[model samples]
Target: MSRQRVVLSLISFLLSFISFSQVTTEVDTTKIRIGEQINYKIKVEADSTVLVVFPEGQTFTPLEAVEALKIDTTKKDSKFKLSRIYKLTQFDSGSYTIPRQKIIIGEKPFYTDSLRVDVGTVEVDTTKQKLYDIKPIIEVEKSSSNWWIWLLVILAALALIGFLLWWFVWREKPLTEEEEIALLPPYDRAKLALKKLDNSQYLIRSEVKEYYSELTMIIRKYLDEKVYERSLESTTDELINRLQLLKEGNQFPFSKETLHNLETILKRADLVKFAKSAPDTALIEMDRATIEKEIESVKAVLPEPTEEEKLLDQQYKEAQERKKKRTKVIITVASLVLLLVATYVGFGLKYGFKYVNDTILRDESKELLEGEWIKSAYGYPPVYIETPEVLKRVQDTLSDESKDKIKQRVFVFDDAEHLDIKIITDEVDGGEQGQEDIQRRVVQSIEKIIEEWETKNVQNIITKDDQFITPNNVEGSKTHGTADFPIKGSDETFEGEYAIFSFATKEGMIAHVTLVWAKEDSYAVDIAERIMNSIEMKSDEQANAEQESQN
Candidate 1:
């Protein structure tokens, strides 16, 4: 009996020792230099079914854990030997104790033994170390890495300076004498033309056609300058007729012999040129002499203008000069404007107009699209949609009798210009109203809205009604059309596209979403599509609850 008792006590002691040894904690070293890491390890032996969780975060108060290595597990028989290492460090040189950390094993909790650590500063041997003076900062020239940039800047500066010098200093110089002579009076110009014709070799080369053509042109040009304004544009017969009229009207004192001589020469020249009637050289010379004498006679008989006529002519010339200058200025400005517009359009087409407008023009549509969007409910049977801006509740202007029969709400997003988005909800007393009756009422409501649009000066309206299904599979009627409407405060008309979506709930409540925008606005279509796709119709109970709350 005594031996058995002693054996039983030994067995109990061994089991208790093994159970206590299941969890053990140790450190690599208790003393360390300041900021030096200490390896602290924890080991646990548990069955595969038991879960062991180590303390996480800053459980070591005085000594911070810099790193916690992943837990390593090894199977020993039916138990897992789990081990975890924590790297700890302390900056201040002092003695510190790591407090006990609570670890969880299955349902029970266990604590690790508190550890003492000494952090000491590193010792320095000052006597044995050789000291040197701090080196002075050397004054080294910094080589420029972007020399080409400076070169380009200098070249641009030189070019600008050259342009300035030419524009301000050199371009305004006076014209030379030859340039002045080129701008001579009309009489001198006619005389010069005659001299040039005489120096030509047409007559010597037996070129009668060329000679006559030049001779007739010179005479007509002289007459154009001094007498009749349309002489150059008129045929020989037309010129004679005009001259006869002028003589009969007493505008010019032309002699009968002079007119007769002039008519004979022009007719003979036309025959030589057009009919191939080659006149003899003697006859041609005689004709030329006669023409010169006739021109001199006409010059002698030319009348001087009265003082009023001279003033009018001078004023006309000055007005022509001013008009010419203004035309040149307009052409130059228009050319610059066209070039800028072309350049802008080229870039816009290449990168997309939206990109150019958003970057350069700061267009409102682009800003609205790219900006923050809001999802909100509108009207009673609230139509849920996302928009670039919040819709505002507008005043209900329906009569009190109409209001009693129908609970109507109107919300609008009006910019007072191009864009006007409105949503209308009408809850009618559907007592004894069938589906067909409800649909008919919805159609009538849409027609009434269209009539209202017409009253607002919407003309040339073209509407098409179609059945559409929402994303949630709710059936609805869509009325879309385009109309020409006058812009506010302007005579200009804008073509506007409007779409009205009428959705009738099972409870006979009609939700009408209306979108109106200028047809030219490219973003309006996208915005309208987005709003239509995002439509979510509320349930009857929710709609009734909202109505009750509103009431």
Candidate 2:
């Protein structure tokens, strides 16, 4: 019984100790403002080490992050204790739920109830649960992007206003004649411009082309606009020639040295501009100085006249006048020659007898060479060819003119497509010794040969002239306003004033022609070919038909 009592007592003591060792937790406050840390303490008198798990979003919203997660360790005799301190804040101003969290004490689970936080706009007790927040910066941004631009715009507007105000005042106030004259820049302004050039630091740095260009222009423009009124835009050579009329001297504004230097610069510039040459720096620099001095040398003085100078001036004026007159005369003569050759050449010689310019000649073309034959612009005009010269080479070559009967044919044509022809003069004129004589002689010779021949016409020779005639009677031949013309080929009486003349029809065919007449004296083969080649008979139907039949 004693032993039993001892064991029971021991068991009771062990139970008391174990029950007392269970861990329990208590919180100082259930909720607090942001940054006011709440004290949560866990009291335990346990035998083994304890581990705790903290809630994630339940403890703090992600955006309202934990500032600090600190572990506090303390020792009590031989026991180890661990506690966590979380420093947390919320950027949001709202009531939020802290979700219930689990705490395990040796596998016995305990859960804390959900807590609400009230963050207010006030200072709080930090020793307790205090809320502290950084105050917003109180500064007002002073914008340079704003008032500065506005001020600048205002300043510009004010400046423009001021300018306009001043301009209106000045402009509205009328100037007396003398005052106006005073306002006019003096003639010495040219001198001032040159002085500025001489003193310019821009020149020393050798901005050569610029310096020379400026210098030359000032002086040249002064001459062009004020003195001679000539276009200095002209070539340097032209400018010099113009100024050469003024006179030569130191006082000439264009002194010899200055003129020469200006000439050199202009010429060098021309070489660069036209000849495509690039000048060396040294030459450019020298030219710059030369121009500067030239510009400076245009002083206020008059050029003097001398007897020799006056004579030369007069002579030059006369020469220029004569040249102008000569040019006009040459142009006139050229135009006349052009008109004269226009019709014969199928274009005016004046471009090919652009006789379209002459009203009279346009109306009556034959009037061009109606007078007695004389040497003309055309070489050896109205040249006559003897019958013997026409046949000189062909004389022996001719099949004895006696192949029984001499068959000669004349077909006048405008186109070379067929044996087509045109008749300019189908009547006969008896020969005499006058303008009429030469013409009739040229006509009758052709008619006599065809008229007396036993003529044959194989096809209808298309004579294009309105007046076509059979190569028959002299006075009785078909003439004008009718188509009586025939293509003649045959034997006998090969003589008289019938000839052919060929022309360029410009109708996609070789020649425009007229069956004409000249005397028994024959013309050159060139003349004969001229007539024959002019007549292009249509493609021979008989021959073409034969070809088709053969095919």
Candidate 3:
């Protein structure tokens, strides 16, 4: 279902709930004016995830909209429930018919009967009364209630300041003993951790795994803190990989032997901790002492200068000299795979979006173009002033960017329901219009629709304002547990997202449109863009003159 209808359906959910596994439909306000606001709510209570649809004709839509549709899904104990509130309204004052709406859930679609309402002409008061004929009630000026309070506060503040000055004249601040000691990190603590290790009575108690794990942790934490500064609490494989990287980068003070000992100790500790194996205390003490010695030796010397390092350096130098010889076979293969995926997704999206954007438009436009139109000299640029006071707002928002590129275009489909489609020309590139709408308009519409959908759908919405993705916070679709992408943009074209949906309107004249959004690398968008760029838009009247000349 469309987002607007989803919201209206939510209203149906809240007000009418039959049972946990069932659906009950109810409407409180049967009558409404053509363009006035009215409220309706529907609710659903279920045990599992359920997809629902609202009555086909009644939904939140712009121009024919009173407010954005609101879908409220609430969970109670083990039951999953959804609620929708629709602020239904119309634009004109006239008797109108609302068709029955279908609600779908769990592969089943339920519906509400068609409802009718009476709309009367707007009532106005023609009788005008004198502006100041009524006797004015005399008002008395009350005493200043805050004057004394302000005076007293100022006097108190002045006295406090004066007293503080006199007190500071003889006052002194002495540093505490604790303040003299600087804060030290785990690395600094690790050097002295051997002392803590000595104090710990591990051998006395039979906490074998705990004792060994703690010792290994101290060693790993020390190496990470003092040497590489990675979190050693991470998995053993991660620690080994990080250590190898450090070895390669010459970013740590450790030989392969020392690293091997550390890894052996850590792996053994993991085994003892998880496998419930008892470690020999005597052997552990001996290994602990050995670990201490290795740590000290590594501290005295930097990364081991093995022949392997020299070989690596020599290979790097040779690679640089003969750079063109290396094709990076691994990366080349990965790039090919990525390109294949992009091509597939791009092509699929292009078809999906084309069907949504073009076929419907063509069908609708055909109905409206009855052959003749008045020459529109009044037509202005096919761009909308999206930002009224854009420069000032952009200047305030971004210090790096001086101004924003805000663009929009409103196309009037001849058939408002099904847009006229299938425009052809002799050459493939030579078409009157593209299969899709303008880029800026697409981006803006998609962003708005997604934001609205989020508000209506996600219970606890956290709107993110920035676009840059950092490694630490990439939150890939898989990582997020949901596949919804945040809206993104760049200056060239709003080339960042997929939130807008192209859909047909009730009027059929407005088809494949509503909140139509496109994502980059989408085949539909790419094809539509290629076709659109080839064709230039002109007023209807200019087309007649061009058509005659061409004929």
Candidate 4:
């Protein structure tokens, strides 16, 4: 009787220890068509004070989790009942298993039983299906992007600014009165100078010395141009001696009276100027008249220009006009070049030399940064992101052996030297063993990527590893580093920075986004960062939700 009582007591204790928590797992269906959904549900019952953490991340290998629904809770007496649902799907038609998932309640861990699912392919009756011939390759014109338009606009603006600066600031002003007179022939110029002198107030102001000085200069200028080129530099006696020699030589035939009058006027004017003599108005006027008469006398004796001389003078004038035009052109061109250089320097000092050069030269990286971008999704279990330009799909031919084990899609944008971007999606044939060991696999993948770079002549690699979360809350592993990269088609190399982002799904699919840019190019760096920030994982649930909303 005592042994029976002890057994009952032990059984009660065991029952009490196991009665604190209970869990149930179920799916809406065990069978589904390809690309169809399976609603998975889990329910738990426990005390209100216990902590519970359900499974997260890509734990159900071979069956992808489309979405994790919000938890539902209710009260039953003093206990709480909690229910959680997850939407799952599969694209390939095959038999797959949903692996066991762990649930932690308070300090104890419990696991739910695994389930089996069969995804069947849709049927197609070929007899009723229409068929078409394969299309031939078509040659399409390449698009002329709007960056050229922007370049043209910038050039036009600079040109207009230069013209305005020339017009308002640096152009030649109109000639003054003296300059206009100087453009006339020597004879006409001298006559106009005398008339201007006559208009002076020398006589009215009792400026007798100035009057006599003007009287002598008028005749000296006429003699300088018509007779002797150096007449203006000669003294009074030297001029008279030169005139006498000319008369004797018959180079010029000056009358005796003309010579006498010229000699007397020059001497008197010199005395009035150097000796500071105060000459009377009558004497000043007489000297001026005599000088004018001598000019007329000299002209009468001077021989007329020969036809050859006349032709030579005309040719000389034409040459002078051409030279003036050439000088004007040179000045204008020089000024324009100077203005352009100044503008470029000013912008460089304010912004940066590289920025100005890139804008003018149409650097690929710079254009990508400033140009309009496109936002689209790539690959299945899509990666949604924005990029400066659309990436082109790469068709990779694989061997039959590789094709059976894995399928891959690659998209890329390469600028040869400055920047390169690649997106790769790979799907394995089957769920890998030890799929829960994500960190080790990720590290192996990163090392493999680095090894590939080594084959391409990338060297001196420095790396850092971190966890990255996208704007949509999708998590992935990020490996980034700096290295020396071989320039394409050349023996040269440059310092460059690189980033690789790796993401995985429960169905054994992996996606990698790799970006590389020259370290000296800030624009390329910015482009890479922007592309990284724009990345998001577009789940099947979000796509369906959007479609339903649209409907």
Candidate 5:
């Protein structure tokens, strides 16, 4: 009997030691006024040789850890007693759970018991606190408006337009010396050419060949313009034969003496030019005189132009002017067009063909992706996010059964073609449900939303469920995949991608953000991802505090 009693006592001692070594948690109070802190203390009794570590961080969700007080340490009979105190609070009035906290003792982990917290709203005395009317909406300028891009585009367009106008119309174009001479009448031009030849020093320098060449070219050019178009290309013998034929045919009533003088002068000029036979200065002067007299004789023999012939000549000059202007316009336009095409090709090679094509064509998705983004807050328990464009509030009609029980606000930006963004916040007027129940309902709501899409003719729905976290560390559930969406006013459907993010708060408020875009648009995909990453949840208290600080 004595041995049995000793065994029972040893077993009781072992049980008591085991209970003392285990961690225990207790809170000062489970109920508190909104924003009031609760003291949560964790106690552990262990051997002095064991190492201990208390939880540190924002792991106590729903109830935020306001501060971690220094741990209390005491020694009793070679055993150490450790107590860690945490100050926690919740800004909004709701029932929240302080999640299990990890406590490390030596190499092993121990968890503190989860605790429930009830935060009650403080009553507002409207009679004492003066009330004011709601303030009017104030417009705030966007931080990143992409004004530089627009400025660049405007400048580029103006440069191109200015260049085109200068090239085609505004520039002062002067005629060349040859063109000025060509514009003169054949007789006047021939007289001018002879005067110019007399001014030359070819004869003084004994350049007989050059002098003869210029003198003969003057007569040939005059004949080519006035009488025979091919005279300049014809040989000296051919020209003389043509003149004789024209005299015989009565085309020109040339005097025999005049023809004989012209033939003699041309043969002498040819000998001086091609045969290298240098004529004396006196003979060269006499030959020049003969050529001058022959030119006058030919002009006298030519019939005077009739009124109709004069009118035709005037019309021909006008036509030539018009042709020159038209040619200038064509050249300018063609050159500009080729320059633009070359620039486009160069940019394409440097960047990519698709990128260049999209920019040149002003693709909507590309513009939105690269344009300035707006950051704003929406709905109660506001969802803060950044987007390409500001979302406009949409009035949604609720079913008669849910009109009194549910209040919903929706904001959206939908082009019905390339991209669509919808943000929804729903507040239910009822008792707070369990977290599991809320999650289940949220999943059902997601399916219902998808079903609604199906009714709208969305097809081939493929979904993948996963967790999504925002840049601010706000976590939510996400459903994303591909689908075929119906195009407006057409029987066709386009391949598209979509993502849905659902977040629920302790106050029974649910916020959902849905994004849909064309599957082939990489720009749209980037925009969507940026929008998602920028998403953050701000409680009314936090928002109000920030606004006050800003003020």
Candidate 6:
């Protein structure tokens, strides 16, 4: 009787343990179509205060968990029932199993039973489907909205050119009055000034002071031109002293009477002009007549120019002409350089230093950026983008057996030395596949690209991949790497950089952009970046419109 009581006590303890650790799992269906959702539920019953945790992530292989739904909780007397649900799907048609899921309740873990699922493919009636050949290459025109920018640039450039031409070539600069006077012979210049003074009515206007000033200037100028170098600039006493010394030294031929008369007239004119002393008009006339006669006398007695002096004067005139020419040349060159610098600065500020360096240094990438860029739709679900050059369509020549499985269109711009860009769009037969199948297709495309690189003798390849998203929030995958390629007909090799962007559209179109270029070509990289930034996948309506237009 005691043994039977112990057995009953042990049974009660086992039942209590089972009630405390209750956990179960169930699925709404065991079979589903590819990409069809399956509801998986886990239930746990424990004390009201016990905390329970459910398994997370893609722990269920072959069946991917799309979402972990909110946990539902219910209280029953003194116990709490917690339930967690997950939405699961399979991309490929196959038999799969959701492994046991662990549930933790207050530090102790319990597991739910495993479940099996069957994924079936959607059947397509090929007889009712229509097959179309790849569309012909459509040439897209460059954008014209930014024409005003180019127009302004051209205008600024023309203005700079015109300014340089005016400064250097087309402009006619006039000589100054002093320069014109300097061009005349000294004697002729002095005589011309005296004649001009005579034509003036200074004396007739009752201007005795003016008359004396003119009279003295005429005499001093004549003396300066014919005999004394400093006569025009020196005072009356200094001029007389210089003349006396010249005459005494026999350096110049001058009569004592002539010197005395000249000195007297100059002193009288200075006193009349500076001291405001009134002079008779008759005295001024007499002084003018005497000055004219003295000038003639001096001219008659002047020594003739020697061969050496004549040669020196000729050489001096030639030197002056050469100097003027040099000055003009310098001015022209300086103006041209200034205009060039101004133009460079204007464009540099508008574009950037990279643009300036690329243009001036003849960088290939810079040329592409500055050149005309075409915008176009390529493939079935068209990819919209801008490129430096128009992409040409390559004929698709896949075998007949595989053609029904996939349709692809390719466009390319290949400049073997600098850049190679290829755009591809593919439409696979299946549309209901999951993320894994999409990812697998992308990987296959990347591998194909790498294989093509191998055919081109590309070596030392280094690759990396990451998730990418477009400006429109469309998600994609990006694979980028570097490699070395052997130059054609040479043993030498050059470094090349490459990038591949793969995207699966909502309409089941798979599109990719593949770009490759010499690593030294910075402008090519810039072009690639611009094209990538401008990329957009066309919607169904837009794609249909494009096709209609092409048709």
Predicted structure with the largest lDDT when compared to the true one: 5
Candidate 6 runs further than 4 Å off: 1-183, 204-207, 248-251, 273-276, 349-354, 375-386, 390-420, 423-477, 480-499, 503-512, 516-526, 533-551
Model 5 agreement with the true structure over 1-551: per-residue lDDT tens digits: 99999999999999976765779999999999998999999999887888887775445765667777777899998789999888988777888778788878888888878788889999889989998999999998667656899999979987987787786575777979898998788899999999999999998889999898888888888788777889989987898889889989999888899878877888988887778998788999998888888889889989989999999999998999899789878877887798789889999999999999999899888999888888998875468989998899998657978755666778999864678899888776553578887798789779978998999999999999999876766678899999998877789988999999998876567889999988888988888889888889854355445544643
Error of 3 at 56 (Å): 99
Could you tell me the lDDT of residue 255 within candidate 1? 91
Q: What lDDT tens digits, residue by residue, belong to model 2 across residues 1-551?
A: 99999999999999965653544445566556655665545444444455433332123332133433444556676454555544555544556554455555556665656556665455667789966699987976433445588889879966875565456432346778666544444345555666677777754685555655666676677676545677467788988776665645323545666667767778777666567666676776677566556544554343446899889979998998789667756765665576556545654444434344443454222222221222111100111121111111111111533221221122222221112323321111111135444445444543543443224322222222222322221111122111223324433322222334421111111111333322221222233334333233222243234434543
Per-residue lDDT tens digits for candidate 6, residues 202-298, read: 8779888887787778778778876888988999999999988988888778887788889899888888877888777787778877877777777
Each candidate's number of clashing pairs is 0, 45, 49, 0, 0, 2
In angstroms, give how far residue 455 of model 3 lies from its true place: 68
How well does candidate 4 match the true structure, expressed as C-alpha RMSD? Answer: 8.9
lDDT by residue (tens digit), candidate 4, 84-192 = 8889988889898887888899988889998999999988888998778999999865556777888999899879977875675557769898889878876777667
Off by over 4 Å in 5: 1-172, 233-237, 396-398, 538-551
Question: Of the pair 2 and 5, which is ahead by TM-score?
Answer: 5
Which digits, one per residue and each the tens of the lDDT, describe model 1 over residues 475-524?
Answer: 78889989997787887889988889888776577899888877887766
Instruction: Supply the TM-score for candidate 1.
Output: 0.36
By lDDT: ranked, best first: 5, 4, 1, 6, 3, 2
What TM-score would candidate 5 get against the native? 0.67
Summarize candidate 3's per-residue lDDT along 1-551 as a digit string, tens digits.
Answer: 69999999988886555454555545566555556665655666666566554432223222133443445667788777766655666555666554445567777666655556555555655576434577888976543566789899879966775565445432444646444322354445555667677777776777787677667876777676456567566788888878788778777646788778877877888888899877677778877887787767656765445899789978987887466333444444565577657765676587665544444455333223322222221111211111101111111221223112211123321212211111111111111233243333334444654465466342232233323221222211100111233332322322222211121111211111221122332432343333222222233344334443533
Q: Considering summed lDDT, which 10 consecutive residues are worst modelled in model 3? A: 420-429
Looking at candidate 2, what is the lDDT of residue 429? 14
* Span of ten consecutive residues with least summed lDDT in model 2: 375-384
lDDT of 6 at 162: 73
